[model samples]
Target: MSGILETQQLTHIFPNGKAAIQEINLSIKGGEFVIIAGPNGSGKTVLIRHFNGLFLPTKGKVLLEGEPITKDLTEARKKIGLIFQNSDSQIVGQTVADDVAFGPENLNLSRKEVDHRVKESLEAVGLSDLANQQPHTLSGGQKKKLTVAGVLAMNPQIIVFDEPFTGLDYPGVLQVLKQIVGLHKNGHTIILVTHELEKTLAHAGRLIIMEKGRIVRDGEPSQLINEVELYGIRRPYGQNRSVETMTWLS
Candidate 1:
């Protein structure tokens, strides 16, 4: 089968003449869990943003399936859900349930269908009971989960997370991690862009690393993550790795 997402000689250069990513050729298979890691400004975000058509390439093209992403940016955006790094920016509705229903309602889904999706999405994120609460009143972790629920309500085929675990304590990370694993098991393609590795390595099959606007390495997470710090990422020391292993296995 053709890859669900592909970038052909993908290159992006800013107006000021700084290159974000250069010649990035990549293919993402359906249902695969991929980790895109790099030091700050290694082009991880620049590359993935092309997948969903948020940032079109300056020189090359991003393809969804065999077709160029530029062909149908609307459909591509619907298929690829990007959960931004700042969870707060994702929240739009005043109430929790209202927020979760935003995407489905925008799709022109019937009221019953929209309600059903809102219920299911909230339940999936373990926030069903908080449906009637004010979204602004939720804690940081709950807000993140709410952000994910909003995306889940859209029912996208591919989910790309940008710095998903940047903020949050241990339990918060575990909560989000569990949701990500569950989504993958249910057959959603998962692409994660994060600098921290130790807690997430066990959950991913392939690792792609970027440095200086170019791909430095792409391989198994265990092999690539251990050596990624040379570029700028630290693999989360002072925390026991065994716990993360258990998180994935459980």
Candidate 2:
């Protein structure tokens, strides 16, 4: 897989003159499952927002397929779908089916095409049976899956999940983790941001640890697993287990 998403000297500064992310360069190849972990205030969220053009860079540029993302914000967003940490914030439609259809509808797709996407997306996430149910009535894990289905409906090539497993119970975490792994296995590039590594580390091909406003480490999970605690992320392995066994899924 070639480089599908990239950042060049990317930096984002808030209105108060605080730089959330400093000059950082990164690349994400197609179909790679990457885990980005960091402590609070490490700029993980700010960095991923630039990928979808949600937050423009303050100093440099973000590129999608070798072209600047700013060149076409619409195309950038369509190809790079973002699932926010809070599922409630992403829920807008009165029902599950309507919420999943929102993205395709906003793109002005034909009614037939929108219906097709909604059906396929929901099926992909195992929410087809709940199509007519209210989104608020779903559980936390189900809500996360709903967000994933919404993003899938957009036909995104790269999916950026920000703290996907947060606020989930044991079963909920497993449910969402299975959905994420399924997405990666089906050839969608996955960039997952979270401080909790044990829950999903085993499935990631690469690991990136961010500190303060810069990328402190980037490489294979096993190579950097030992050093994650230095940056305030808990080490998930012990003598009985290794990086490959650090996941919650069986």
Candidate 3:
């Protein structure tokens, strides 16, 4: 199967020469939902940034559909959409509808097309009712959904979510997880950067575990999770809860 995205010998370093990513190579297939699992400072965010051209690789290349991603960025970014960890950083316009329309607007799409995409994206995330409200007025969960809607409006082939479940309450986390599953059902290539394993392992087809800036394990989620020591750096959700914990295995 052809990969939708590929990285060859990928590495990143700060100006001070602290390596964040080290000699990584991975191929992400189309229509597959893959999660990058690791503890903080494992370079998960840095890796995703390369996908959208947010951070240039210091040592290797990022290829989109087998070709090197162009430095032009507009074209490269059009193929891969990135939803940031902070919802506030991605939102632009005051109103929800306008904010969601931002990406399509950059594409110079027709007003009708932009409007249609804005409405459809908002509806996909179950935020159609909040379209006219100000982003600042929406709850943290709503803002995250709004940012995701904006990314969806671009209709990119792949979506990279950086720590999406962070800071959300239980209900909010479920909402985001469901939206992610819905996107996968619709056949978008999904790359999720998260420390939370259980939610993603249950949902994603593939799991890549990292340690100290390198991919230490990459395989099916079922197999990877069983190797507890390889993934010990990150803990599963509800580890302290007894009732919901045992139910998952059965």
Candidate 4:
């Protein structure tokens, strides 16, 4: 129960009978900032889907705080928020505030409570003023922030991010990265999946590298990812991209 999550012999096979991930054994402690790095189709997404009971393992069980994933995921998901990479796919409302309120509303919270969560989450993401703005009108970085705010409004104990920086400019990428650090400092357990090793190494406390549906290495970011080829994993971001450690500037 101490660890936020635990998986035993987790395997995920598509309906077409192709195994996306096989025999994954991982444990994540509370308030840990763990990032999963792999190439495209490495099953990072599939693996994360099991974290909050989105996808059950084909041959094993996923434990969230020692509870097995089940049909009624409400109790478990309240503590584990999953933030997709695309805001458009996740957003359900027109305005930023409305989108942030969706999750709390579904939880059956009172109107006033939902309002407070929306306001606080927006402010945390530095988008308090954009509450009235339409999600489609916001920039790529702002949209990502809105998506993050939506997840935060749920008041989750742990958050799973799937490639938070897929299509963003330099500033846009920095914006999400800043929020990640801020959330971690605020005592939120974070598991982020990304392909950009340089950006990830800059913020992640622990790094996990996966290849061919299994974790080849897991340790401090500076230790393993710096010498990726030593573990037989592909280099990311155009070969040997490097960045020093940085927290949010403002």
Candidate 5:
């Protein structure tokens, strides 16, 4: 099967003349749960921003299912969903219902279809009751939930999450984790970027670590747990990483 996403000799330079990422080559398959762990400014965010053509490479190219994503950014985004670290930044609609329906509406789906998706997504995220509430008025955790609901409504095959657990309390984390697992079960490729290994380590099938804007390690979760801390990431606390942790994550 073709990789759902691929980057060929991908290199990116910011306007400041700093190279954000260099020679990134990746083949992310469908329905895989991947975790990207690295320190701040390691180019993890910049790299993923290319998957859906949010940040086109200064050189080389990004491909979605073997087609250049930049050529069809709108269609590429429909297949690859991106959830940023800051939920507040992604929330644009005034009310929760309107926000969740934004993507479907953009797709030009009929009103009945859009409404069905909005209701289903809100219920899935446990935010059905707050459908009419203003997005800016929701609590921090609620905002995060709202953000996920919007992406979920899009029904993308590959979902990229940047620091998914940010601003989430313990219960909130569990809630989000449950939703992530559900997405995985539904066959959506999950590419998660975060430093919090303990919360997500157990569910991830593969782990990739970056340092200084380059991929340093990529392997099964069981094989690389002890090695990530050297690259500014903390190992997950209190886990027997010797055995397969893929099931643990699920």
Candidate 6:
């Protein structure tokens, strides 16, 4: 079956002549929750960046609905909203509402439409009350939610989150995790990248493990959960708990 988004033999080499990712063929169907996990330097970030044309492939190509993403980078990005690991980096406006409106505003949307999107997106992430607050004043978790809101405002069919839980307290993790699961439940295809599988493994339908710039394993999360430790991602299970119980929400 063709994927809503796909990468064929995707490879990327940095200017230093090092291949960050190599021969990564991936297919992501609509409404699927996929987790890409690996230790640091495993090319997880590089791979997702290509999904929306953030970084062009050194080899192969990225397809959105079977058409090259390069053919219309703008449209591809609108369909594939990426929430970066560092939320602060994605922030731009002085206020939370303004920040979320940035993407829609760039699309030349009418003021009413932009306001509508910003309002809906902020509410989706539970940040409606903080719309007038300065972004820099938000907590780590709130900042993450703000980024998600920013992406959500773009009305992307797919959302890619890169190391979303990097630095967050227990409450922060729970907040972000709930938002992610809610997005999936609401019919958004989710592509999440993180080595901390214990926080979200149970929620994912598929798990893809990467090593040395290539995918080493891809299958059902339960089937691959035991093998993640082999690729340097800490196994989220033990004798007492199973993959189904490996979520921060519980």
TM per prediction: 0.93, 0.98, 0.92, 0.91, 0.94, 0.98
What would the per-residue lDDT of candidate 6 be over residues 211-240, giving only the tens digit for each residue?
A: 999999999987887677788888775755
For residues 97-204, what per-residue lDDT tens digits would candidate 3 score against the true structure? 999998899899999999999989998999999888999998888888898899999888999999998899877787788788888889999999887766666767
**lDDT rank, highest first?**
2, 6, 5, 1, 4, 3
Whole-model alpha-carbon lDDT for candidate 5 = 0.88
Positional deviation of residue 224's Cα in model 6 after best superposition, in angstroms: 1.2
The segments of candidate 3 whose C-alpha lies over 4 angstroms from its true place after superposition are 228-231, 237-250
Counting clashing residue pairs in each candidate, in order, gives: 0, 0, 0, 0, 2, 0
Better of 5 and 6 by lDDT: 6
Pick by TM-score: 2 or 4, better one: 2
Ranking by TM-score: 6, 2, 5, 1, 3, 4
User: What is candidate 1's lDDT per residue for 1-250, written digit by digit as tens?
Assistant: 5789988899999999999999988888998999898888889988888888889889988888789978888788888999999998889998999999988888899999999999999999999999999998987788889998999998899999999887788778888888888999999999999887766777888888889889888888656645767878786564445323523335
Q: With candidate 3 superimposed using the best TM-score fit, by how many Å does residue 157's alpha carbon deviate from the native?
A: 0.9
Best by lDDT: 2
Stretches of model 2 off by over 4 angstroms after superposition: none
Alpha-carbon lDDT, every model: 0.86, 0.93, 0.84, 0.84, 0.88, 0.93
> Model 2 — TM-score against the truth?
0.98
Judge candidate 2 against the unseen true structure and give its global Cα lDDT, from 0 to 1. Answer: 0.93
RMSD over all Cα atoms, model 6: 0.9
Q: In order, what is each prediction's RMSD in angstroms?
A: 2.3, 1.1, 3.0, 2.5, 2.0, 0.9
Q: What tens digits encode model 5's per-residue C-alpha lDDT throughout 84-180?
A: 9899889989899999999999999999999999999999889999999999998777888898889988888898999988888877787778888
Provide the clash count, candidate 5.
2
Clashing pairs in 1: none
Q: Can you tell me which runs of candidate 5 are displaced by over 4 Å?
A: 239-250
User: Local error of candidate 4 at 57, Å?
Assistant: 1.4
What is candidate 6's local distance difference test score?
0.93
